[model samples]
Target: MSDLLERLRGRGWRMTAQRRVVAEVLDGDHVHLTADEVHARAVTRLPEISRATVYNTLGEMVTLGEVIEVATDGRAKRYDPNAHRPHQHLVCGRCGAIRDVHPAGDPLADLPDTERFGFTISNVEVTYRGICPNCATTA
Candidate 1:
């Protein structure tokens, strides 16, 4: 997205071919790609792009709030590009597949009043883990 690039440029980021390729690889709906996976896809378009470049670009995007880093099972972090809206993750325990899900109630409401500990809570992350339909059917 040109708008993303312009925002990046405004943040003093030097636009490079590799960075552009990385951004292109991540632009899509429900895209949850690891750094290595992103590098592999970016290489298809820009053969010269390196893994480090992809990692760096991904980090930059996350820092800019254009991407969100999700850690499932403490394995490789996945990069999610759906940062425009708020949602939580529904993760498949068997295949590690992730999908965005909006739960029924406000997450902040679930926190116990005693647990606030005098700190203002600005956000919350709720991750629901279970066997996905494909995994459950095969079992």
Candidate 2:
């Protein structure tokens, strides 16, 4: 079972055929697929599945905190299923590929009291941008 599917089932999320297809399409490491891309893949598994269904399922998953919506490069919002883990993004500037990167310490602790402007910091999002190996080799 995919991590996203397992988490959804554990949370008592209703498992419809369309939702299941979407979850399966999103199952994998470094998965950051846009709604259209997800819909395209879901159509391969279940021919009757609609684009709206994929969009709605993704929205619900994002709302439920089971999936994370990433808008890298401002092209389209990509859905990430690795929400249960704490990690950052490494994006390829040339090809726009994204990968999950786990750096050493706690980012929350890195912010000192003096640097914080008084609001409580609940989370942090870090994105490292550079050319990926494939793009670098091609260039």
Candidate 3:
């Protein structure tokens, strides 16, 4: 996307072939890829791209809020490209598949005043883990 490239350029980020390939791989709906996965996909377009370059590009994207890093487990962090909107995550516990889901209500509304502990809270992230429909059917 030209908009994404413009934003990155505005932020003083150089657009290299590796970085461009990484960004292209990350662009699409429901894109959740790890650094290695990104590198694998990027190499398809730019065979000279290295794994380290992919990781660096992903880190830059995360820092710029162009992507979201999701830790589904204690293992490698997964990168999500749906950074334009605010939403929660639904993870399949069995297969490690991730999906973006809108909950029924504001989750923060459930937090009581007593839990504030005199500190101002500006944000909250909710992660719901369960077996997805396909996993459930297979089980």
lDDT value, candidate 2, whole model: 0.91
Q: Which candidate is the best by lDDT?
A: 2
Instruction: For residue 137, give model 2's deviation from the true position in Å.
Output: 2.0
lDDT of 2 by residue, 73-115 (tens): 8888999988888889999998898999999888889888999
Question: Which residue pairs in candidate 3 have backbone atoms (N, alpha carbon, C) closer than 3 angstroms, thus clashing?
Answer: none
Q: Candidate 3, residues 63-97: lDDT per residue as tens digits? A: 99988898878788989888888878888999999
Clash pairs, candidate 2, are none
Name the lDDT value of residue 40 in candidate 3: 88
Model with the higher TM-score, candidate 1 or 2? 2
CA lDDT, candidate 1, residue 48: 87
Cα distance off (Å), candidate 2, residue 13: 2.1
Candidate 3 has its poorest 10 consecutive residues by lDDT at: 1-10
lDDT of 3: 0.84
Write the number of the candidate with greater lDDT, choosing between 2 and 3: 2
Point out where model 2 deviates above 4 Å: none
